[model samples]
Target: MKRILTTFALCSAMIAGSASLPLHAADAVSNTSAEKVLPLNQRMAKKSPEWLSRGIMYQINPRAYTPEGTLKAAEAKLKDLADLGMTIVYLCPVFVADDDMNREFWSPRQKKSQMDSPLNPYRMKDFYHVDPEYGTDADLKSYVDTAHKLGLRVMLDMVYLHCGPTAVLIDKNPNFVKRNKDGKIITGPWKYPLLNFESPELREYLFQNMEQWVRDYGVDGFRMDVADGVPLDFWEAARVRLEKLNPEIGLLAEGTRKENQLKAFDLSYGWPFSGPVRKVFVGGASAKSIRDSKEGFRKARPIGGDRIIHFIDNHDISNDDYENRTEERYGEKGVNAALAMMFTLDGTPMLYCGQEICDKNRHSIFGSKFGCTINWANAGSEEAKRRQELLRSLIETRNSRPELTFGELIWLDNSAESDVVTYLRKLDGKQTLVLVNCRAKPVSVDVTLPDGVKRHFDLKDYEFVIE
Candidate 1:
């Protein structure tokens, strides 16, 4: 006779207290055991590091950060970022890139580079070494060391899903590469050869490389690229190993999977919220869309301790379409309002390298070939000075106010929902009210507080206030 397993039998076997109970009784006992396992949100909140909750992330595209485009040159500006209240410095991929530019399948962005042999940082040739164009391994070490001294954490952008055709792994471990049924290597979104995560040897190799960064460079964390493409189990296993090295190390996933927040990642991108924000401010959509999106995100991910990394602009958006830049499309006041929402909202805020100066130029990952370097000369201008002061104030406020970082968010309905957004954040008996005008015209709104106190606000074009 074949053996059979039933739900009641399994429950009875697993729970000692349910072993002697009836079938229905055992089912109830199993349900009780299930309740003991905390919800995903509470589990995430309990396990996430304190530093991650209060961090202000700043992205640095080394190739476009300075005229020299070297890590050593970029190191000189660390103090400036620290002064601006930035807690984390995220560096884009600096590893050696494949030099075979003659490949026909190069992406459109890659072909725009002016150099005869354009070195796209995303195409990794060697994970172990830093690209000489950006300086040596010693330079990277010094950069991390200096950041640590300034009380700033460092996160490297990890591209583990795919690699250049001529990557070192191809010659050393060919079986590590993913292939189709026809025996040809599989390509990913960037037209690069994908890695086979099913191979334990390959997984171990990548894990070792991750450890090398922590062991040798003392990196605080990693911002995973195309994280959704990789298996969730791999990230879960990687997090377990990484935690043994540094308990505080953070893992930021670029994708938006809710499960990523359960175990594999500390934070994920806030695309759901950002898209509606762009629609409202840039596409002339109703401001109410912003509120709807936020509520939708909350409903979709009911277990809410998951954190999102919010940004007005990042490398991919800025590079893909120069015209879509926040500053270029929305102008100075619009940029300020958008940033205010990002800083005062529920998620952790991030700033791209040149965003503070109202940089109108695109800072491409491919350096000046496809885009321009930050005009440091603009720092001395009156306009740049004003932007810097405003950003500094915002950052300081966010860092000092625990209420803004760990508060409960409540959206307040207002008369001007079409052109304005109003919300409240409460924590530990402290309440903060945030009002933002999303349109280019003045807006007046009547907002009634939970205490039944009514107040009126008149805001100028694209203005934001935190009370």
Candidate 2:
């Protein structure tokens, strides 16, 4: 049976005339000739000049980023990455893997039991320390320092769902891990041993570790992994605790589930919407399917005033599962359009490590050590060059338009026959109309802008412009 989920949209509708918060007008610049964009949303009104609500984000897999394979090397590329319009840099997994080489590599005996990789950034071997392979403690400090110097906020990949077999939680405090009926620890791939959040000791340890990261490293925030597995109460508690460390410390959840919304997560992965949208845009599914999935996501997810991370593909798809097949289906042209849609929509966009160059090398965390590296050689290709530039432009466009970031989305199905997906983002007093053609040919249709919109600005260069 198909499952239907209820969202805050319905809940708010039920309360109708009753107001929860006031909708304030945006200070979006009325001057069309202005060269630079302004951050005028309600959320950013009180923030510092460096405060960021909408901008580009870059994802770097340290191991694959450079031959040196160290945080220092990743730091060297900050300038290049910043040039691409990155306001944030998300490092996948920087913590040390299992110390023992034999224990680190996944073997036949451990395959079924492991839920993640020995190198999985989600499984922490040491909370207070940095992985020697990635870099020393000082090296990590430099990475964060350089990122901030470059005007980019750094977010660490916080994997709290589980820990490694020989981690402090498992060896020192056996009570920290979840156990089965027979008192045996429940195991999964990647050797993930679940944390016992019910225990105060375990909860305190996790919270303290989080607090240390904020106070010591000056890390901007956390990109929590497997957020769904953790207890909601634990997160709500963490949210309160984390704010004490740094009120500006952002919270981003890796999972896309309904229950995550009511708690402390500031941003959620729009996976349900992204997957179906990509499939439909890539010709794997029908336009009707895309529309239905988007409608479902809108109805189910309580995303108003909160950020949702939108993407065409991340490491899970770009590096592993969907790698080999994506190029054949979408080709260079199709992927560019897909990136445009992902970045321009009403969400914070996420770019997987290799997506900038159409890295279709089938990234593998379990494959050959050197094979895991990004094929920098592919950057010379025309297709790769085009995609890279297209992504940069899209991100730059997003940075220039605050309305696209915090605005409300109004999807327009102008010509389903032509496979065109269009939408208008309205925030404060600014509005942007984005039209993305998913089909092979150019699709055109007359679009009516909101009253007085055409008189103030021009949007014709864009697919569905007002003036």
For model 1, residues 1-467, the per-residue Cα lDDT tens digits are 11111111000000001001110111111114454385533332224566766888999988778989999999999999998888999999999988776655465677664444557888889998999999999999999999999999999999999888889988888888899888789887678889999889989989999999998899999999989999989998998899899988888888866567656777777776677877777888878777676565544331443467778678887776654566777777777777777877776789988877877776677666544777788788787887787777778777666667777677776777778777776777876777788878866778767666778877777767677
Q: Best-fitting candidate, measured by lDDT?
A: 1
The reply for model 1, stretches above 4 Å from the true place, is 1-46, 112-118
TM-score of each: 0.89, 0.79
lDDT of all the models against the reference? 0.74, 0.60
Q: After superposition, how far is residue 416 of candidate 1 from its true place, in Å?
A: 1.3
Top-TM-score structure, candidate number: 1
Q: Write the per-residue lDDT of candidate 2 for residues 1-467, one digit (tens) a residue.
A: 11111110000000001111111122221323332143222122112112435646677777666667789888988887777777888887777665433454343433432333445555567776888888898898888889889898888888777777678667768889889888888655555667788889999998998888788888888878878888778887897798888887777777756545444666666675567766665544654454455555444333232346766666556544524645555666666666666665655677777667777655543322535667778888987777677666566566666666666666554433235555566777776765555555444543333442322211121122210
Candidate 1 residue 232 C-alpha distance from true site, Å? 0.5
